[model samples]
Target: MAATACRRGRLTLPAFLIALALAPVVGGRADTSFDTGPELGQRLLRDVVRIEARDLAEHGFGLVVGVDRDDVYIATARHVVARRAPAGLVEPERASHAIAVSFCALPGAPRQLAAMLDGFDGADDDLALLRAPRPSAYVPELKALAPAGKDGVGDQVWQLGRESDCVVVPTPGVIAGRPDTRHTVRVDLHGALGGASGGPLVSGYGIVGLVKRSDNEVIRAHAIAALAARVRALAGPPFLLGEAGNIPPGDPQAAVADLTETLNGYLFAARDLNTLLRQEIVPRPTFAQMVQRYNGSVNRFKAARDKYDGTLQRNWPAGTLPQWQALRERLWRIHLRFFGLNGQSTTTITGTERAPPPVREQMAALEPELAGLQSDIARFAEHLGKRSIDHAELSQ
Candidate 1:
């Protein structure tokens, strides 16, 4: 249905200078299920950015999704700045200067930052990313819904944008239908949506979608979870936009430091698992105890590993990415070996209750390997520290 709307010219792609309006809902009936609080609306306003491409003579709305190192990432609709290519996908419109993004939250003067078009996730998702230099001022931390699926029918949502008079207005809506297409969801708004394409669709405290298009009462938004993955793949590093705060401001070293913290957790968990597998305990624990301990250790290790894996590694020093990736691979191999030692399949470590014969010898064999990996990691950290010092010196 959406595909046909675009092709037949029914779906109006809002451009600059369009007089948009939102008629009041019939009977002024409100959905009593959920109420978007004023406090949340104020917080969301901080990240609502108005984008203007002077060269293309077009303007649209965008959300400040992330700030990574020196870059601030903004998410907007692809059609806002691009036309359909021959292949049906979209490409960035060549411009003389960067697209101007105005942060409405800044007090006094409205500061506009120049943002470069990063990339797009084809026409299906209809999402694009704009990357700009991080401002000295504070950036709002936007949380994204984890499972950004398009299945939230009847769930209340609020779309924040600065389309009318450049003021952030919160439009309440409820997810109406399941989009047959992937990476999209339909929302029936209480009021007609204006030219706010590329704004955020907030549900609760987290952003669930990016407003893509609207037809009177109903609008389509690109789900944030899917948009996150697409942006991660396109932009590389700064993988999780919402988790940018996890890394410090001074990047490269900041990323390295953050990674080291996760690795430390992994080391502690691995040590516990190793000690348990070797049966090196004050009181020789029973098989059940061993199983419980093993499961617990595995969970901790996996958590740490995932944290390390999901980090923004593109700016990690310079040559440290390969080393870190190698270390991650080695850790993964060790995880697989763990299941092997327990006589369990790597795929099915879930609800593992039974224990195999004593894996003392196998566990013993992995000690040297673990020790070697630890030594390598230590060297890696040391290298990272040296590189940080060198970088700081170079900058000076």
Candidate 2:
């Protein structure tokens, strides 16, 4: 059971990472270790702009970090702008909703500048560029772009973000590591907070990356130069940038296959639960009752399992155990209540009132079936257990 719980925990980490990544960017608080230098302070304050967007009744806040001519680009996690425009809001099959950008000299001061929606991509880019109608003379002196470069392990970097009310002054840190395949750069910025997405990462000269989200509150910024290159390649010369292009056909198919495999593993894991109930426990119910209950439980599990499987099939992970365990436990308990053995009860049904001989015969036959279910369940459980152990060992 300890091992099982740990396996469930491992499965939950991805969802946790995603949620942390999407958390609202927080403003910076004071840090004695790193002072916001006079020159950097002016640049950071001027470059960091607040992003306010509306999708129907929903409103969102993010940070705008980069500017090109009249276009000011915001860097936020994809989940921040996940909502799509409702159908019929504009032309048939066209999206009408737009994102808005605003900024003020001071936190509570009246907005000094604003712009209507230009375009955005929630998936590949996770960055949105908004074009202002007219160039605002208030444009901050542009921070130098990070040279086209690859960050090595342990490179020093600094991040600027917002907490609740104040803009986070740049907090300095070193690159902890780079992600396996993604354009993620892990840093050690201390005191980074929520509402910090779209904040800038500065080295010596200019912006190196945009603070997207944190991993365990250790700052993680996306490589701005790399992201811009991808965006430009996919969206074409960045003219009024819009949605990032769909994943190429080949990639989507591979994603589908990966999802199918994961779901198969989960289903394989679930079958073990049913088996454990059937074989290890005793005083099992009449075969008919057993079948009826099993069928009902499995049916419900199938419904939820299928929903999750479909999501996995689409190459996305599903809910954590706490999110889905109630239903899972229901199935587990149904098996235990009927099949689990206790000492022969003092209160007993008289043989005269016993179920029909056919029922008894059927129940007798189920012993083998029960054994089979247990074997399958135990096998899958062992497999999943081994996989979990291996992952833990690797992490260690």
Model 2 stretches with alpha carbons more than 4 Å out: 1-38, 54-73, 83-99, 104-122, 150-152, 164-170, 234-396
RMSD of each: 23.5, 22.0
Residue-pair clash count for candidate 1 = 0
lDDT of 2 by residue, 53-121 (tens): 455332223334345565555455543444444546653322224444455334554443343334444
Clashes of each: 0, 16
Indicate which candidate wins on lDDT. Answer: 1
Span of ten consecutive residues with least summed lDDT in model 1: 13-22
Alpha carbon lDDT at 376, candidate 1: 78
Candidate 1 lDDT tens digits, 38-74: 3344556787777776666667788776677787778
lDDT against the true structure, each candidate: 0.57, 0.42
TM-score of each: 0.46, 0.39
Determine the C-alpha RMSD for candidate 1 after optimal superposition of all C-alphas: 23.5
